[model samples]
Target: MLDQAFLLYGANGYTGELIARYAAAYGLQPILAGRNKQALEQLGAELKLPVRVFALDDKIAMQQALQEVPVVVNAAGPYDFTAKQLVEACIAEGRHYLDLNGDAIIYDMIHTYDKAAKDSGVMLLPGAGYDVVPTDCLALWLKQQMPDARSLKIAFAVLNSSLSRGTAINTVLKLGLPGLSRIDGKLVEEPVGKRGMYVQFPGMKKKLFTMSLPWGDLSTAYVSTGIPNIETYINMNKAAWFFLKGQGAYNWLLKTKLVRGIANAIVKRQSPGPDKATRDKTNTLIWAQVSNENGNTLTANMVVPEAYTLTALAALLITRKVLNKEFTPGYQTPATAYGTELIMEIPGVQRGLVQ
Candidate 1:
């Protein structure tokens, strides 16, 4: 045995459960953990794995749990609430920490702990999933083609996929947030959808409209490639784009606690995530372009499995590598630690230069 055991907090969440169910296939053992005792017990029995039930606030219990594994995969979202606690504990305990978060702010916060993580010989990797892995890799790949690139743009689109309840609630919670981008090597905030474009992703028949937002790449890609200006966009239909532009009018309402509470209540009543059948049919598309002052540019495109599916695979893949002692001892994005080929390791991923 390779002693491939690790701790998986929030193991009852949609993405976490998916990772737990597939841990065996990856030749790893995950000790399921979370606050929901009932859910954790059922899942642990089904998966035949050890179980640890403790809320993130239960510091003593959490620290005791950390002693069972050398790595922790956090599948909990709205990472703004969960990341700080778990990351701090991981650094203190010298355990590698990984999360499937794509929030730019969260990435920046984690980066601030780089020195502590390095000093502790702990690897802190955020966005170890769909949020940034493919795009981060693509960004680095495009940068490789244009080593002197001054600007970078990356976009992603999901086809035939639906959001998990956790993802939906997180979206509602951030409804009125401003967009973010990196300019002149600094993070800048601006109106959401401040920039829009049409992208013809690989294998797609037609172009899709995309709007720039504060994606995790706005933070992580800059670390991976010192591109001075980086922008990230997500595909949206014209109607959605129009509504997003008009959101400023109701931004205040969306930010109110009452509206957010109602939104979350509704989200909780829905399905947790796409069923296995839907995940099997969905595809994720990503595009990256890099340009220099002289107008030289290179574009790359990639197609991968559904977002949630890819999240599960990528999170576990990175976990497996960490257990095998194949990781750096500091803060890292997927591409920064494992290189551009990290995305290619997923079974259904394909990448190529744009023609």
Candidate 2:
């Protein structure tokens, strides 16, 4: 029964702005919000949408903000600090929740809210963006193909080299942390970037050096496909790999509160994100290969719009679904709640290109 308009918290962030404009084009007047008064005002002025400026930690402000919108889409990253507060507020206010977060730790922690969310009669769906939408849908499709699959591996070959400031923070939040894998149906942490391989993305001719990275799939894929022993990789050059590996050695530095503060400050000062030309020109190719103990393999890939564009599309798509009379409350995985064809609904999403 939550029928108010959307509250797009963190609406001035890179992906948040894209979602805001896309929603406007869809005839939605979402309330723009975030901690920065200047950025919020700037975005509100351009979009002509109402702005609500408030810090995440202000419970009264957050609660009042939630009451103004039936659903809230969080575009903030390093969601470690933001997601919990907003989600809790949504539950308290009887508002639905969605976000662009892909941190496995956050995803795992959020799963604990399932019963509370269901009791509140509102959905609390994360991984609603490029972080897990495309990949999660693909995992379920592979499961449909090979129901007996025992292991799964997903590789991300983001044809775009430009990492948005938002994504950089998401990456930095877990930097130096061990990679995660679901082994025999339980989440396990292993040294990330410990090994490497060459993976030829389906749409590409040449192979790229793919290194292990802890992605959201470490948790969501299991809920979607029940495939144990999963590993997600990202295409990276030697220099990127070197920096990633070096994190393990210098993790001591990353653990310091001062270093965390400095990193967050650096990210805040970064440009909002790539330009329109950059988003249009770049494609994100994600490949997933699933196999059973019998050696039968089901492999495929998806060629989608740039990560930010896809995030906007996915956000809109989910918002529409959440607005329907028939809603599935509680914590939900992308594919588990919507099925494998979810990404197909997005504009410019190409799928099933096998290697």
Candidate 3:
């Protein structure tokens, strides 16, 4: 049997560090692992946790690194390259997998391996972070309130001073990719900036323009609520959309390995993430509306602290639940395994339906 320990993979990254800090405070002695030995050593020194160093491609080494930890809280991003491998390794090692990844591709991959995870008696819980945790819970809650709903719309507003290097790089990679929506229970791909609209919030005088994107909930919500029509949007201004809309045009260039390498190189020199004070001042809001075929509708809004901060808190809480044996095997969403009120457990999160 695997030991009852959490493994903080990619513990050297900015988000990983945030999770490690909270995991430590929560009295979790997580084994910090990543490719950067020096960085891992530094973080381990501060957190006083053991460190594991191995590249993502080293399958044997990766499996060995995970042997002692029954739960893996992956905080790495641009997870297109990492999530699959980590999931495979976890299943093999009989370790429950969790991550803050918001990528739609990872969700698609999870769908395929869910059965494998079940057979291994391990759980694969992705998007435990800000990407789909709160949004998924809200979607499930709305479904309970209006079980007849056939359509759903979710919008996000993230207020932060700057993006972490991992986040910025993920943005660069995701820019040119086409968007997606769930229509009539089918995953449908749309143009890069399709369905752009200015959405209003509960107490905001100013409306924010949001472009359709393949958020994690696009996959998780259907499993959680059985909603047939789903659409997700990220808050963006005209200036930001201008650049976002242009991605498809130059996607041919941006998609090339050479260009992506350069982009990653440029990101490497920049700061990892916001400072502690900036993070303390940051916040996020999520608004969701669900409507039935008969025109009955329900709307709810949620507010939480900074995206990164929320991820840290959510990760720890979820991890604690897993450790205490409040767990479910196979691919799971936080809302599905926990409940519609899971988001409410967070410190600053508040949710209320619009009357």
Candidate 4:
């Protein structure tokens, strides 16, 4: 048995493939798994790692796969559909569950399994990837800086990156959904792009325009820091911001099955994601602020590698920690489980307060 190995489901997907390819660099091996037998075999052969063919629906096979490894890193998307099932299996098998999910609803869903996971000695950590790693770490760091923080805001932008087919499809599915925020300790719905601002991120000469977004931190950050008010944002250009601000006018059309089908088809016909050249040159900018009751605020900025690159590295980092017997059982965000400095573990990450 390989001592440092985990089962990587969805290994056929773009992000999953990346994680499998990079596993050796982290001094680990991944047992490639997924429903696509042919694809899994191809990936297994290339990586020279074991392959387990099983779908999430196959209870026996999945359990066997779980038995082969101490951890499971789910790189699948539309996590709302995938997370709960994998989490249940992990709990039953006493295996740690980790995923690259950034959906608030999935976080809320997985949180309900805290006690079961704790009892089973399984760590239920979602957003082990770029979804909440950088932002969650920033939230905790800011909380430490302002212990009495009343509100928190986080914003991020992929300087030059493209989404994988799975991510693009998920985005299409959420076209008509409302934005979300935590207000006074309650999750509330708000219009997408309801608010816009300009932020001068560190290392950038000009301020980037950002608009309100319903990021996963709306759920994870509150649990991580206990801040009563929280909101998230994404960087956008002026034209895109204006277009999103007016999303109400055509949201109905966007939600229609026909439109979603067309959009998904287009995404499928496109490249899997940014090419290697693009990913190598890309970066992500993250900005965050925490404020006290008196309106005093402290702001911080961070820059990391492109989204997909960071996701693979971050996921493996957490997996390695679990392999090393370092983890808190039960539901956890990255920073809350690891600490605010966890984000710094990834290569090419720079973070500091904005003076």
Candidate 5:
């Protein structure tokens, strides 16, 4: 049996630190666990919590560290490299697993372990972050409002400052990669930046162009709402899109061994963006428009904080639910596991249907 409160893996990373602070504010005495002993110690001292050191590569150490913890929040990102090991450890220990994974590949990989997790009765929920939570939860809410909806479209727009090193590295690696999403009950390859449309968002009534992307929430929502056709769009400025278009040279660089060197240089030289002023000025908009056979449409809006913080909060909230056995074992999304009613209960969130 696991103890009531256990650990937060990767508690030393940039986003991990934010999660630690948020967890502390929530009155959770989570054991800070990560590879860097010094960084973990520094964070623990700051948060006034005990520190535990365990590298993800050391399976024995990870298992031993998690033995007494009933739940573990994997705040680590670029989860492609870390999710599997942590999930395996949690399964072996019957501990609940939660991650703020936005990588679709990682989500698909975790979904493969659904049967194993179910058999062991360990809850596993990935993408408990801003990427999927707000959008997926909104989709669930929209479906409930329009039970006859057969097809749906989600457009997500975030106005914020510069990108983080981890985000940049991940994006560079995934550039030009094909995306997959279920369309009309078939798995289809989504063309990067191929689809675009203008849609109105709350507060800002102007229509903005949105492009199709592979968001894990769509897959989770398909199962949750049984909606036949689903599509997700990300709204960004034309300048960003043009910048993304100019990344051919960067992609070539990533294909070589110099990627790590280049990434390190960029991180050292670049300043962290979306500063306090930028974050306060920024806002996230999620629009889910559902249409039925009769052509009736319903739209809803959601406000999200800076991407990383929202993801951390959503993951933390899901971790709490897993601890209380409020969710089921096996692969699921926050909206699917917690339900829209519970998801909307989180503070700083609002829900409404567009007339």
Candidate 6:
């Protein structure tokens, strides 16, 4: 039998706490865990779930913590720094793994472990979150609408939910990095801001510029769906765009110890994020367009839940699949394993297509 699943790491972080609360609502009672026992205890108390403390740096502790948990939902961020060790432990323990990893670099690294995971009979799914789940599912849905589809273009826009400190820190770390995608079966690095365009979203038609950051969902979606030509774009407001454009300075600051200290202090002071009222009012809009060799087209709209809530929902869904033996033992995207029909069944998710 599959053992109890745990919300392994980052149970004390802002997004982690939100995911814990969502897990509680579903009566899953995930074992809250992190390096900080006090913070994990506080979060567990707030959610009324059991707490288990373990440090990712400590291999012995992590293995001990995995004793009864056959699955782990990793909410940790800057996954490029944290994913490998836990994944190694999961492989050793024969445990399934899921993570809300939005970093394309990290996803690319994990994809290499596909053969290992398959050989070990343990599934490893990254980007099981708002970053890719909704958009990935939409891609599959669009292809189904037009069976002859040969290419897909996905554009996503979120008007709400302030970026978390972990996200900001990760972005800063990745500054000046060239963004890459698999276009027409070839890897291509495209200039930043040169690929901006307007997407006619459902209920609102607006122009959204392309995000310079790379998303992991594209890699997994392509591998899973076999779509030769695919591109994923993210659109944010002018202020956010300009702020990201100025990240070159942040990257430079990270090089100096003193400057890095100051930056970390500033982030720590401002990392709490928005209040409940602000979060409850937040929403997301996604638009996808698929084109086929037969000159046919299909478009769809996806209404996503609050970003934090959606992370928990996606993770829980993946864990449930692992427990039910409904997943293949390998690295894959959520849509690849669950399919568009199952993802659309989640409440509050809206789907539409235009021909």
Highest-lDDT candidate: 1
* Cα lDDT of model 6 by residue, 1-355, tens digit: 2244565578787777777777645546578888888888887777677887877888888888777677877887778778998888888888888888886667778888888898889888888888778877878777776767778777777675677787767665654566676678655676444355667666675556655445765576676667777777778565666665555556455466676566667777775655677767866778778888887777777787777667767777667667767888888887777888756756678888754
Q: Give lDDT tens digits, candidate 2, residues 1-355.
A: 2353688988888888898989955556678899989988988898788999999878889888887778899987769888999888899999889998887788988899999999999888899999899999999999998899999999998875477887877766665456777789888878777668888786677888999888888889988888988888998896878777667678878767788778879987888688889899989988899999999888888888898888898988888777664468898888878889889998888887474
lDDT of 4 at 300: 94
Cα error, candidate 1, residue 121 (Å): 0.7
Against the unseen true structure, what C-alpha lDDT does each candidate score? 0.92, 0.84, 0.86, 0.91, 0.75, 0.73
lDDT of 4 by residue, 208-284 (tens): 89989888999999999999999898888879888887888888998999998998889899888888899999899
Better candidate by lDDT, 1 or 2: 1
Candidate 4 segments whose C-alpha is farther than 4 A from its true place: none
Please write out the lDDT profile of model 1 over residues 209-228, one tens digit for every residue: 99998889999999999998
Where model 5 places Cα greater than 4 Å from the true spot, the runs are 1-4, 239-264
Better of 1 and 6 by TM-score: 1
TM-score for candidate 6, please give it. Answer: 0.88
- Native-to-model Cα distance after best TM-score fit, residue 280 in candidate 3, in Å: 1.1
TM-score of every model? 0.98, 0.93, 0.94, 0.98, 0.89, 0.88
Better of 2 and 5 by lDDT: 2
User: How displaced is residue 110 in candidate 5, in Å?
Assistant: 1.4
lDDT of 3 by residue, 1-355 (tens): 3344698888899989988888756667788998999999998897778899998898888888888777999887778888988999999889899998887667878878989999999889999888888999999999999989999999998766678899999977864567789999988888766778887765578887788877888889988999999999888877877776667678788777888888888988999888899979878878899999999889898887888888888998898889878888898998889998888888888889887
Inter-residue clash pairs, candidate 3: none
lDDT of 3 at 117: 93
What is residue 101's positional error in candidate 3, in angstroms? 1.0
Ordered from best to worst lDDT, the candidate numbers read 1, 4, 3, 2, 5, 6
Per-residue error at 252 for model 3, in Å?
2.2
- Flag clash pairs in model 1: none
